[model samples]
Structure formats: structure tokens, C-alpha cells
Target: MCTEELATWRDVSLVLLAAEALLTGLPVALILGASLRRLSRLMVGMRTVLFQARMYVWRTGEVTRRAMGMVAAPFIQLQSTVHGLCRALDILGWR
Candidate 1:
């Protein structure tokens, strides 16, 4: 009779523990699922914002590079002219 009562108590305790785990774990799982859903949505928006920022930076870099090349053109041309004149003078034995 004591052994039977012990078995019954053990079974009851197991059931209670199962119920407690279900009660706690289910809400935590649901909350985690909801948070993941919200995070995925936010990530979609962030992806688009990052892509736009990248395009803006690319365009700005392209414009700046073109402007720098334009600004340096006259100096490059003058240097080339001077080098050619020096070469010609050397070839003519006039240096």
C-alpha cells in the first residue's frame, strides 16, 4: 500500500512538472516567434536603406573622381608639353 501511494505521488509530481513546463515554455516560444517576425520586417527596411546609401556613396564618389580628373587635366597637359619640348631639343642637339 505504501509502494502504491509512492508511485501515485511520483506520477502526480511528473504531471505537475509537465504542466508547469508547458505553461512557461509555450509563452516564451510565442514571444520569441513574434520578436523574430518583427526583426525580419525591420531587416527588410534596413536592407533597402543600406542599398540606397551605397548607391548614394557610389554616385558621390564617381562625381568627385570626375571633378578631380578635370581639375588636374591642365597641369598634366603642361607637363607632357614640357617633356616633349625637352625631348625634341635633345634630339636636335640643341640642349
Candidate 2:
């Protein structure tokens, strides 16, 4: 082929490649924008959930601590009394 004709075909090929690239890239850009929007919303929701979970954990820990404190002395006393009784019974050969 003549150099001019070959150059013309090369130009056409380049135009076609550029057009195809634009067509392919446009949708990818749009999809990425949509994905970013969705991701932003998801992040906001996750932040709220994490905050609520942290609050719940703090409240539950406080309640548990108070409940344990209320039960602690009684529980210790009961355990010691049981131990003493067992020791006395063993000394008396009542086991």
C-alpha cells in the first residue's frame, strides 16, 4: 500500500480506538461515582451502628459492675461459711 493510504488507515484506527476507549471509560466513571455514593452512605450507617454499640457496651458494663458489687460480699460470706462447715464436719468424722 501507498504510504499515504497506510497513514490514513492508521489515523482511522486511532480514531476508532479513541472512541472505544471513551465509550468504555464513561460507564466505568459513572459506576465508580455511584459506588462512592453508596459507600459514603454505608460508612455513615456503620458509624451510627458503631456508636450505638459502644454506648450499649458501656451501659452493660456499668450495670454488670454494679450488680457484681451488690452480690460480692454475700457471695464471699456464703463461700467462707460453707468451707468452715465442711472443715468442722470433716474434723468430727461426719463426712
TM-scores, one per candidate:
0.58, 0.54
| Positional deviation of residue 33's Cα in model 1 after best superposition, in angstroms | 0.5
> Model 2: per-residue lDDT, tens digit, 1-95?
69999999999999999999999999999999999999999999899899999999999999999998798978988999999999999999999
lDDT of 2 at 1: 61
**Candidate 1: residue 64 lDDT (0-100):** 94
* Model 2 misplaced regions, further than 4 Å: 58-95
Clashing pairs in 1: none
Residue pairs with colliding backbones in model 2 are none
- Residue 16 shift from truth in candidate 1, angstroms: 0.5
The candidate maximizing TM-score is: 1
For candidate 1, the TM-score is 0.58
CA displacement after TM-score superposition, residue 10 of candidate 2 (Å): 0.2
